[model samples]
Target: MSEAAKELNDIKRLMMLLLLKLGASPDEIALALQVDASLIRKTIPSRKVKKIVSEKG
Candidate 1:
């Protein structure tokens, strides 16, 4: 990938981690980070998704 794309991916990963830690939804974190929610969702792991969902449930 190009440098910019790599950077964007890295930022998305960080945003996903931060969102999980902060208990924020993907849409909320995407809006705060000014990126796409699909990107955040794609970067997050299934285990992480389960954890987040379990916490909210």
Candidate 2:
């Protein structure tokens, strides 16, 4: 990826984590970002997803 593209991707990934931290589900995050849930799942590490989901409730 180009540096700019990588940076944008990083920002998107960070936003995903932030949304999750705020108790948004992956599906919700995807919807808010206009992306697919599979992309959200692919972007975030599984362990982090597990941690956030567990802590969300």
Candidate 3:
């Protein structure tokens, strides 16, 4: 992929992480972003999810 596209994807992933930290579900994020939940779930690292969940819990 092009550098610009990669950067955009990285930005999107960061947004997904922030949304997740704020308690947004993957489905909600996907709907809002007009993308698939699987993509959102895939883009965010598993460790990040665990950390967010632990911090929120």
Candidate 4:
């Protein structure tokens, strides 16, 4: 991927984690990010997701 494309991809994943941290559900996150929920699930493990949520909570 191009540099910008790679960064955008990284940022999207980060946004997913951030949204999850803010108490957004996977469904909500998928809708907000315009991605499939399955895509969201594939991008990051549930364990890390929970850790981010817990850290922010």
Best by lDDT: 3
Candidate 3: give the clashing pairs: none
Candidate 2: misplaced stretches above 4 Å?
45-57
TM-score of 4: 0.71
Worst 10 residues of 1 by lDDT: 45-54
lDDT of 1 by residue, 1-57 (tens): 999999997886776786676677778877987989887677784345534344543
Q: After superposing candidate 1, which stretches have Cα over 4 Å from the reference?
A: 1-12, 46-57
* Per-residue lDDT of model 3, residues 1-51, tens digit only: 999999998887888888888677889998998988888787875446644
Judge candidate 2 at residue 4 and give its lDDT. Answer: 100
Candidate 2 lDDT, 1-57, residue by residue in tens: 899999998898888887777667788888887989888887875456534445533
lDDT of 1 at 2: 100
On the 0 to 100 scale, the lDDT of residue 52 in model 1 is 38
Better of 1 and 4 by TM-score: 4
Clashes of 2: 0
Clashes of 1: 0
Candidate 3 Cα lDDT to native: 0.78
State in Å the error of residue 7, model 2: 0.7
Worst 10 residues of 2 by lDDT: 48-57
What's the count of clashing pairs in each model shown?
0, 0, 0, 0
Candidate 3, residue 25: Cα displacement in angstroms equals: 0.6
